[model samples]
Target: MKKTVHVVGAVIENDAQQILCAQRSPSMSLANLWEFPGGKIEAGETPQQALKREIMEELDCVIDVGDKVEDTTYEYENVIVRLETYKAKITEGAPIAKEHAQLIWKKRIELPALEWAAADIPAVEQLTK
Candidate 1:
């Protein structure tokens, strides 16, 4: 049976109303695809906690997580991904891509121009709508 990985993503929007997007590094599984910055939910941690920790680790920034944005379950070749995205705002420090190839802030309308990871598509669509 394929294992399911539950993950949280943050749709961080700045004062300019642009959303933060991260590009997966060459070494990452979904290399070169864009995604919201976040990671897997560790045991015993609430989704909010995992999101905070992940943003700090992956983006070197602190965020205030808000309402849930979207939830999607996608099956890949080797695993099933359950991704939950939430609205967020950076509270401390600017984002610096620590694990990704790069980071960009884009308007919701422009989000569809980039190739996104499959699991993140639903959230992107929601944000653009």
Candidate 2:
């Protein structure tokens, strides 16, 4: 049986209206693909709490998690991921790529142009709508 991993993601938008995207590092399971910048939800943490914690740990920044944008399950070859995404705004510090290969801010229309992680595609589609 495939392990189901519950993860939380953030669609962090800046004042310029561009969404923050991160590239998974080479050592990650899904390396080099773009994602909405978050991580697996730790046990006992709410989605919001997980999002806040993941952003802090991954980007060295604080964020205020907003409404949930997507909640869907996607199966990778090795695991099934339930990715829950929420709209977020940075509240402190700058986003520094601590665990990712890179970070980019792009407009919604440009989101589809990049190769995104399979799990993040649905939220990207909804954002572009």
Candidate 3:
């Protein structure tokens, strides 16, 4: 089987020390789950380039790619994702969920209450800590 490598980006804002999160679209595979905004890395694109494109397409915003926080690999029923998470800062535009159902800003302590994608569990834990 051919494994698909997907690069995912996580956007974080220091709102007095909190992070921004978006709810996944109901029609999406990981429906109703809360996640840091990101998407798959397309062919011929670097992970950073892919992240910038995905954020622009999904949130209609510009972000400054910060330090790479973590790289994780996880498996789903249909595909495997090599999720590359980064600590991102929004340079311009407000975040609107063009692809997601809703958006939210949460403190580190509140992260566990929101439903997160299975692959994101570890990432979430790390972020909250």
TM-scores vs. true structure, each candidate: 0.99, 0.98, 0.92
Please estimate how well model 3 matches the true structure, expressed as its whole-model Cα lDDT: 0.83
Worst 10 residues of 2 by lDDT: 36-45
Worst lDDT run of 10 residues, candidate 1, spans 120-129
**Residue 117, model 1, lDDT:** 98
Question: Tens digit of lDDT per residue, candidate 3, span 14-99?
Answer: 65678888888889888998888898888898888888889899989888888776788888888887888888888889888898
* Per-candidate alpha-carbon RMSD to the true structure: 0.4, 0.6, 1.4
The TM-score obtained by model 3 is 0.92
Which of the predicted structures, 1 or 3, would earn the higher lDDT when compared with the native?
Answer: 1
Candidate 3, residue 69: the lDDT equals 68
Q: What is the RMSD of candidate 2?
A: 0.6
Instruction: For candidate 1, write residues 22-102 as lDDT tens digits.
Output: 999999999999999999999999999999999999988999999999999999999999999999999999999999999
Flag clash pairs in model 3.
Answer: none
Assess the local accuracy of residue 126 in candidate 2 as a C-alpha lDDT between 0 and 100: 97
- Itemize residue pairs with steric clashes in candidate 2: none
Q: What tens-digit string does per-residue lDDT give for candidate 2 at 1-129? A: 999999999999999999999999999988899999999888889999999999999999999999999998999999999999999999999999999999999999999999999999999999999
At residue 39, what lDDT does model 1 achieve? 97
Model 2 ranges with Cα > 4 A deviation: none
lDDT of all the models against the reference?
A: 0.97, 0.95, 0.83
> Candidate 2: TM-score?
0.98
